[model samples]
Target chain A: MGKVLMKGNEVLAEAAVHADCRYYFGYPITPQSELVAYMARRLPEVGGLFLQAESEIAAINMVYGAASTGVRVMTSSSSPGFSLKQEGISYLVGSELPAVIVNIVRGGPGLGNIQPAQSDYFQVTKGGGHGDYHIPVLAPSTLQEIVDLTMDAFDIADKYRSPVIIMGDGMLGQMMEPVEFKEKVESKQFDKSWATTGTRGDGGPKIITSLELDADSLEKRNTLLQKKFAEMKEQEVRYETYCTEDADYIIVAYGTVARIAMNAINKARETGLKIGLIRPISLWPFPEKPFEETRKRVKGYISVEMSAGQMIEDVRLAVNGHAPVDFYGRTGGVVPTQEEIYEKIITVAGGLKYEHENGI
Target chain B: MLQEIIIAGFGGQGVMSMGQLIAYAGMIEEKNVSWLPSYGPEQRGGTANCAVVVSDQQVGSPLVSNPSAVIVLNNPSFDKFEPKVRPGGLLISNSSLVARKSEREDIKVIDIRATDLANELGNSRITNMILLGAFIEYSKFLSENSIIESLKKVLSEDKYHLIDINKRALRKGAELVAVF
Candidate 1:
């Protein structure tokens, strides 16, 4: 395959199209506006359906209903619009449907301006809607990773019969890069016997609902869902480590912030600081293995992000006081400069240079 | 080698397309590249800008603060990004719209009357290609042939007729910067 210079949002829509997402329902918003627009233009060429629903709520509900038929279906939006789709997402999970939702996060508390932000970290990782449910969350940094992970999101959703979320920021959505897409192929490799297509009369119509009137049945259902989530945690954990062989200082970051931390890690290494990084591709599973492996001989861990301190909580939990866990971030649509992150590492080191322990 | 560049101008000055040309050329040369634009309200209000990072290594932090090169097409863009260029970096400005000739002694500055020259070439839209051409000559980041190959990717098929003029504009800008 040859590389093409493409925008993140448009390429992401095509990424799903290649993964056989034939049904797309979404509302237009900044950053992710391009994705919905791309889907509207490209889906029909592939003999698919693209709907610009009246509202994000309506779009998500459309996804929920289409997903009942066991089709490759998905929707996308920015920060505030994503919040509107939370109830539908929770409903999709409760019903155990395979659906993909994308949130290209932006600044917010209200209708904040359009710029990159990671403020939705806790909302996405902790399950935005009400319930004891968790959606498989994939966080990809670059456009190439976005293509790879968007395809993975659909597969993970179908394989587990659970909802999936692609957590991206405005930066990831708006940026452009050279990306080579995976080749398109025939999909729908999962069994849809439990779908609501119709009754085959083998026994009777299958009932698909989160509502269970019987207390014992509800308990059993919840236990089954928990076990499924546990399996996802065990099998779907994805992470990458950079120069962490014998690191004294480790930075924990994900998505766009992870790339920024790499710049800092590279610079810090030049000054004789043993710095490394852990980039968690799957945000929900929270890649705890890297923290345990590096914190053994590390002096400190800093979580860099575009939020006040959401992922830092997960970092703290993963470190478990094995090493000092610190945070450095900027909220409200501002991206942290690489120099600021390098300074954070220096501050975390208490301005003291590391001694050459095993002089490499 | 890494080239962190900022292309800033008014909304319709081809600032984004200029950045895209460089990025696409970088991709043609098989280099790691990222192009991030300052999106939303600013495009409608006053100025528009985009950051381009072309690197031999992996590109990180697409938001470039200290740029290795800056090309400003208007006075406002000049005022804002003139001092942001790295020491010993390069600054290329459109002298027709930007009145400030040079302000920094640390960096090499090339002020070309891009708008005037583009007008002479009968299409003011090619003004950005001129500045882009000058940057290409100065940094040697990507070849003109690679840029021409990528032009076929960015321009719609209907506008294929303008590729030759855009190529001429790039050459004009490169010629102006060759002496400086």
Candidate 2:
């Protein structure tokens, strides 16, 4: 297949369809509206269902219902819209339903304008919907990675029987880039034995509910869920590191900000700063291995973000006092410029001697 | 090499499509390309802009903080983005809409009367095409054939009839830059 220029939202929708996600329930929201719009146009052609529900709340419950029927299902929304879906997400988690939810993040504490921001990192990777559990989330920076991860979200969802979140932002959702959809690996296949598919005439009864009256049984279930989460954390960690082999300083970022950091890293490298970037692809799994490995060697870590400071905490958690973790951030939709980030890098490494840092 | 560009104008002035065409053309030529629009409440009215990156290698960031070239179809965009052009970059403004020269002395500026030229060509809608053609010619970093090929991919079939006029506008643009 040849590469075609496509917007991030549309490509993500197509990748979902390619992953055999036959049902989509979503309400329109800025930035990610194109995903729902594309599904409305493309899903029916592939014999899939596209439903525009009354509200974000309605849409996520619809996803829960469809996913319980053993069908691949999804829902997408931007920041304000996504907040309304939180209750439904928690319910899906409690039920262990395999579903893909997309949050094309926009600026916000409260309808904080319709611009791109990564403020939802904590809400998404941590528990947004009142739960003691965390969900696996993929934050893809580029359109091509969006394709790979959107498709992977389904497999990961089904494999773990948990909702997978694709954490994108308006910058990624609205950007157009050259992408070639990969030939799917046959969705990896699933039995879905616990599905609520219609009962055969004489088949035994089955129930699909997250409500458990007994405290003991619920605790047992929670323990099993914890085990599965542990497995996912060990098996599904994904991340990318650039120029980190022999670095004196490293930058930690994800999604759109990570790409901006890369441009800054390149400029900083030109003027003799031993800098690198660690971009986490899977936000929940968090990819701590790189941080653990690089901690003893690097002088400090710069955590850059579009929010006031959400992901920086994760970087700190991973670094664990091994090095100084500095933060640079912008909130409410203002993107950081490369020059400013480059200047920040120079500031971080200004007093350190380059030759001694390299141990020459 | 990477060409980081910003194309800006009012909503009806084809700013978004101009950015898309550049991205599509870059893809057709087998180069890495990205198009990022300036999206906010302003998109509901007033000015619109998009950043385009066409590079020999994968683009690190689609957001162009400083552009190698800028195409402003209205006075406001010219007023806004002219100062952000990289020192040795290029500026192509719609002289028909904007009445001032660039305030910067470090960069090259091309004052193409794209709106007037398109009107002379019997299609005011082709004003953006005229500007795109001039950018390609003046930059000489990309070719006209690549853009003509991209139109077929980007435009709907119903609009295919306008390809001839668009081609002419492009040619007229290229011709303008040749003698300037």
TM-score of each: 0.97, 0.97
Residue A357 miss distance in model 1 (angstroms): 26
Worst 10 residues of 1 chain A by lDDT: A351-360
Model 1, B1-180: lDDT tens digits are: 999999999999999988998999999888999999998766364799999999999998898999999999999999999989999999999999999877679999999999999999999989999888888888886998888888898889998998999999989988998799
Of candidate 1 chain B, the 10-residue stretch with the lowest lDDT total is B37-46
Candidate 2 residue lDDT tens string, A1-360: 778788999999998998998999999999899999999999999999999999999999999999999899999999999999999999999999999999999989998888999999999988899767889999999999988898889999999999999999999999999888876565587879889887786587767888988999999989998999999999999999999998899999999889889999998888888999999999998999999999999998888999998888898889888888887898899888788788888877885333332221
lDDT of 1 at B56: 96
lDDT of 1: 0.90
C-alpha lDDT (0 to 100) for residue A20 of candidate 2: 90
lDDT of 1 by residue, A247-318 (tens): 888888999889988998999999889898999999998888988788778887778989888998898888
Clashing pairs in 1: none
Give the top-scoring candidate (DockQ).
2
lDDT, candidate 1, residue A107? 95
How many clashes does each candidate structure show, in the order listed?
0, 0
lDDT per model vs. reference: 0.90, 0.90
TM-score of 1: 0.97
